[model samples]
Target: MTIRLTVNRERWWNHVVGVADEVDGLIPVVKGNGYGFGRAGLAIAASKLSPLLAVGTVHEIVGLPDEVTPVVLTPTWRPPDTTEPVLTVGSNDHIAALRGWQGRVIVKLSSGMQRYGGNIDLVAAAQRAGLRTVGVAIHPPLAGTDDDHRQQIVDHLPDIDPSLDVWVSHLFPSTYESLPDSHRYKLRLGTYLWHGDREALHLEADVIDTREVRPGDRAGYHLTEVPGAGTLVMIGAGTANGVAPLSDGRSPFHHRRQRMALLESPHMHTSMGFVPAGDPCPRPGDWVDLQRPLIHTAVDELRWI
Candidate 1:
């Protein structure tokens, strides 16, 4: 028994292709648990759209298909020996480390977001250091109106070399389209590209064991008392599988049977959920419906449908 992510292949593929077609220069960000589909899965999907695939670290570059060129979004701690990625340079230290480094680099400029980037002078420093410049990267916040942040990019535009392109992340479709033609923009997208439609995906956990319990019975790792008489179900997902408690005390219950049950804290590779005495009790090996953010899921546990 195991927890798995089930993706509606047909619908999800349609959306992936649609987004690629709409965004002329799309560089799909396939990093960090691969956005719930694993790095290889999204990398394969991104290859169908463009030759460029964006990754968060250099370690993730190995499994990707050879046809795709990896653009590492994070600064490299040490010079990687295997692949020459389109690197990200956000500071003078990043530029200094690239003294003898070869290959293209993107100068990360600061937007109002205030994370992972530096002033526009870093671009000139990188050029002075003799590193090949591909373009500039900007990660903008999506909260409220993005106009002020978009304006920030415009203000920094003069700092960038006219020949270089611009790569931006977390921009709304409207903001992406609103950029002036004077600048070439490539959208580095992850959630918006892969998990755009939540309806296209679902997750389920198989029931591994079940035990009948009465009210006041202790249950789970913490041995908390059961509120009422019901069946104690051992599910196949836990903290190891990236199942976490919701911040607002909400449950990711999608099935009608799950609605009548109380989900308890998950263990390493299993979880305990209590179904009320009147509700249908799941048998061993039965699949229980569940949902969680794709970003929190482990890659190997996914089973694409």
Candidate 2:
């Protein structure tokens, strides 16, 4: 039993290189399951594009190739145990925490997202401490348009030193190119880089078991009644594999180009989905298409074709 991600290697690699060529200074983000390719794999792939890579935290810095320099995106109050990766400082407290460290740091500026980041003044404050201020980071909210994000970055330019590099996220390629070239800009991209060519990627899970059920038949852990006389297809993906119902509560499993109904909530390592009486159903050894997002899923195998 397995959940697998199949990739068209040629198309996927072409898209990766294409994005690298289009973006001026692309800092490939290799964090949080590496957008489904896994972090180690992304780090290796990112090495071919840029020397610098951005990760979600210091802990993700491990297992990276020596050629790639990692920068931690999350703000940390305590200094990282290793000074290898550059750290992000968003507040005075964060800056003060690493006052004596001689490593590089990126000062995060507050933006529309309001998730993490400090005022522009934090840049100078980090320099005042013993840390080497390498760049300034701006993570704009995803809710706004590219123009809005560009304006937000422009609005902070006067206060930030022009010499320091500007790292930004959530901007379209055209919008990023529209920014002033006088200042250096590095776009931290993850989703756009890896998932740009969705047609090159596919996800599927194996049918581990199946059972014939009648309408009103009690089944599953909670003894939920069967909705109709159909075949109960037990899928190999479940909560353990980040397989859950869609946000709207629809089943994430699909068969024969039709969405299957969930028999009940997903359990540890399997989910039960029902195929209607007259609909096409998958046998125990067959595979079913899964509709869950790759970033949120854990696949048993990754096959590159």
Give the candidate number with the greatest TM-score. Answer: 2
135-190: candidate 1 lDDT, tens digit per residue: 99988777646686678777877767668899987776678889888888898889
lDDT of 2 by residue, 1-305 (tens): 68999999999999999999999899999998888888888799999999999999878888999998899999777776778889999889898889888799999999988887888888879889988999999999988788999999988888778899999999988899999867899999988999999999999999999999998898999999998898899999899989999999999888888899999999989999988898888998899999988889987899999
TM-score against truth, every candidate? 0.93, 0.98
User: What is the model-wide C-alpha lDDT for candidate 2?
Assistant: 0.90
Query: Candidate 1 clashing pairs?
Result: none
Per-candidate Cα lDDT values, in order, are 0.80, 0.90
Task: Go through the candidates in order and give the C-alpha RMSD of each one to the true structure.
Answer: 2.0, 1.1
What TM-score does prediction 2 earn? 0.98
